[model samples]
Target chain A: MQAQDLTTEVAGLSVHLLRGGEGDPAVVLHHSTGPIGWVPFHDELAQRFAVHAVDLPGYGRSDRPSWARHPRDLAILLNRALEQLEMDGVTLIGAGFGGFVAAEMAAMTDARLRSLVLVGAAGIQPAEGEILDQMVLKEEFYVQKSFRDEESFRAFYGEDETGELADLWDFSREMTARVTWRPYMFDRRLPHILATVRTPTLLVWGEEDRVIPRSCAELYARALPNAQLEIVPEAGHVAEYEQPETVARLIAEHVGSLA
Target chain B: MFISYFTERPYQDEQGEYINTLDLAKSNADYNPVLGGDLYHRYLDEKVYAEEMGFDGLVLNEHHSMPACMGGVINVEASILARITKRARIVLAGNVLPIWDDPLWLAETLAMIDVISRGRLVCGWVRGTGRESVTHNTPSPYNWERYQEAHDLIMKAWTEPGPFRWEGEHFDYRYVNPWPRPLQQPPPIWIPGSLSKATVKWAAERQFPYLMLATEHEPTKRSFEYYDACAREAGHETGSQHRGYLFKVHVDETEELAEQTARKFLQGPSNPFLEGNQGQVRGFMQNLPGMNSRTEVLPTIETWAPAVARGAQRQHKKILEKKKMAKGKDRDYSGSYEEQIAKYTIIAGTPDQVVEKIRNVLEYLRPGIIAIWDGDGAMSHEDTMRALRLLGEEVIPRVREIGKELDLHSPFEVSPVTNKPVAEAVGVG
Candidate 1:
């Protein structure tokens, strides 16, 4: 299905969301690269549930608001966005840096979110390996670290013929920095907040995810009030693009089992 | 023109191979403190001699876990300079403005320095480079906002009768009072900028003298032009007194020795003090995102002159044309030491030759205050002192005359600060 563009203004800033599919409401939160619009993973989800793939304010097509200084600030904006869009009991699925935003949203008081799914999420300071400092990583080195499926990874960016598009890819990363550059990526308060998460949550990991440490997956699963963990084998940080069928099947199963 | 002597107070020289082999992926550790202890005293001695050399100001700066400077806590260095240097204006070319969780402490420290220095303190509030974000563990995105808010709070603490409650988005203080008010009314605030429109605009709005740090002449003119536009918009007139410039320089009896002395400026004198834009950050950690803004990105692209966007465009076209040549046929950026001298990025030679190079910079840039980085890289303490002595005897005397001929005035000569009452308020600090 061709994704339809939807924009909603909050506080004089417009947020871009790519909406498609017809079923229960779901919001797909993109990684630090932000969304370049409906990848194959989102396409897979659109087959089962209505997915609102976001280019959160400050990322991609969305207006980057300076007032959104902290992770919780982005969460509050997302919550308001959900409310304004009138999508109650929506399933929030976040990936990588977007997973950090999702964690914040899920941890909030009286959150409108029905369930949560974090994919190679970055929020908790892992007790083990360090999260790769994304801002400083060169594109060539990052591509190597990002995917076990290098062929698929190259194909993803290979779509952009113009250097302009490649540079535009960095803007999302810039927005991610604005959102999560400080305290590195994890909010110290997040572990406590995750403990208070009122809804069930899902933590998914790529077996070979090189960007965020695997220990982070274990940390999230242990911290959340009601959460389960899933590791997709032979995949990297962008697990969906890597193992789209496996990742999408897991999400579908989680959504089906959502009480 | 207001002349100051500045140095990064580089650590004891070490083999560059350690840094070259070291993985930036793992990051760098702090320089050995044992070595720092010796270098600190030697640098302090250099500043003490600079005042005696008739420099109008003595400058210092700070960085953390970085090999370039031992000024991790610059206020401490400023305190030392304040006590030792008598006449020269002790300018801290900024306390990395945002890193301070408490600007009140900064207010107190600068206030004390002002009293100690006898009203000779030019507080340069700066938004430090992006590397500071990693080293200091401060937020990178809000660096500008924090710098602005922190400056506002500190200014209030200094000028406004404080003990007043203050609240802002970044900072909140109840009973905002600072004891030992500054010896200079609000102390002269100068801002050193790398290349940011926001900073130029902010500096202009407050009439704060904007100092461009070791930048090319054409870009300095463009930045000053930007500042002038902003100042005019803010309903003020801007001139040389409203701007400042800093550059590395060395002078000896002859051109050969001076040229050799200036080699430290290449690839920078130290490893980590290496400029971020020149392939350093990209080579190491492109993953560390969000420190750069649109303005920060444009400056390197635009070159020394924002107004010369067309010139930059032409330059880029030429570079592209060169790139299209057979792989080995392109321009080699690694020019000879003679080329660097001709570029005027570093001023070196006998006193007369140095003066001529400086005059070219002065005519082109038109900064109100010019800071001489007399020491950089492997420049020894004795050599720095020698440079200072030459400036005192030959360079400064001629520069002052040139300043007169050009109608250039230092900030002190132009903007009248309320230092008298502030001085009187501090009876005997």
Candidate 2:
């Protein structure tokens, strides 16, 4: 099936949704650090499952509610929007900061979610010495530590500096600032809340992830009774960007098994 | 050998506008300076364009906190290139692996790229420049040792049979196996250098390709000789068996126009040390020890300017200084344009002249492969395209003819067109 086009709404503090495919429902949440442009995982899954990718309330084309306190509030609002759209029984896929909201939504909502895919998911506070804040924030630092060679960096980020899609990142960064302005991360109770999520979970983390440590993926795996872990080789927090095909394949296989 | 073009903005006016050596550099800020989207787009086009042009291999390198050289995060470039050029051989002429305490992560990411590109990976090991190492707080004195160990460990993960224990000074691991084995058995290895003894000897012993960036004839010749001699002494084959050079290239209709453009773009009021000299020397020393010694051998800036000025008066004085300090025998930068054309070592002429020069270099070096390093000093897109179009349509065919005459295997082949539509495939594009 062809990929769906993007549509918008004003329900529960305005949200933009890109709908695609037509089968078992899958709700895709983009990272707070970027727009809700469905990553490769969601794109691949769209071939089978009916996919609903939503821009967070404050990100992409979504209207930001001034009263929205944190990502959890955004998550609650997403739950309300899902209800309005009647997209039930979704296999929720959340990456980075989006994972934080997915965890909260899983805990607070009673909606039917088939499963959950958390990629380099962020929510739990990292152990001392395991998390390196300085390395994560600086582009040079992360490039030096995460990528093995210049080619890998080029592969992760496109080689061109003057292409049409180049400026898409500017909008991404602006969206990130809007959602995660005050504190980049969420509450410390995120893991405790995630533990209550009984949805079948698949945790995929980059072995070289500096933003959220791999150990944290392990922690999430242990916390969720139905969770399984897959470590992407040679990737950072943005594994979908670096090794999209591999990540897509994994998602397809896992989601296919459930179907 | 893989060739990746690097673009740099060498000249900065007091008003903050950068003038490029090659007209192509202007594109870096042409679309939108603050947004940086245009610059990124141009880079992507270049990589895809290079692949379509039929380069045997393409390369990308890393640098940080410098405007002159803007490829701060090369992985970003590589990831995009992988999607655009699914068939071309891609080389990350290196990642400064030593700076990161955990290099395994890099190994994993490269392995993923290898998978994505279907195994066309050329691994380049580097111990970043002094300025970068200092700024990042990565140990400099032991960078070489760290780089060597990292190389050994990563290779083991890529090639060796599974899950072995790895214990080294910098990194210690109980399990050393990596998944998704690279497609090209052991991916080809190339070491970039300005002229470092340690790197030359290491590459020579292993018979890996040697890449000389921004190098001159005299020092480059000595380096080739040294590599050859070392290989011979070690009972290994050498010479052009695995040697390549990287230089800023610009080809126009006339030599005078190209030189004039180069001079106008490369000159301006930028600080020599910050803008050019120190980074060049420091990058050489840290990554290539042999180049450090060579830097001491060549003539100093004051002495070499007069000599080079006679030939190319518009040349950057600091560049001449660095060239003078380079070590190596066969110091032959003197000759009429025609005489230099006869040498064919550097391509800096019209299409025919450039083609002739490449043929001569190929004949003289007889190296297995050559990489054209065309990125430097803010070469503009228009000029780059002109050179690329000329080379693809003219220079490459002539070089193939020369290779045939010499009974050498052609380095590239045009892939046949497929019947399938691109939009239908899964990750095929």
Interface RMSD, all candidates in order, equals 2.9, 15.4
Winning model by lDDT: 1
The local lDDT score (0 to 100) that residue B189 gets in candidate 2 is 76
In the range A1-259, model 2's lDDT, one tens digit per residue, is 3456665564446688777777788777876445636556566777767888787776677886645546777777877877777777788888777787787788785466777888877777666334433212322333334443456667555654543232333334334433443344546777776667778888888877777777778788877878889999978776766787787678778877876
Q: How well is each residue in A105-214 modelled by candidate 1, as lDDT tens digits?
A: 88875467778899999998988988887655654456557787668678666755554554555566566667677777898888976888878888899998988998
TM values, all candidates: 0.87, 0.49
Error at B314, model 2, angstroms: 26
- The deviation in Å at residue B226 for candidate 2 is 1.0
Q: How does residue B144 of candidate 1 score in lDDT?
A: 78
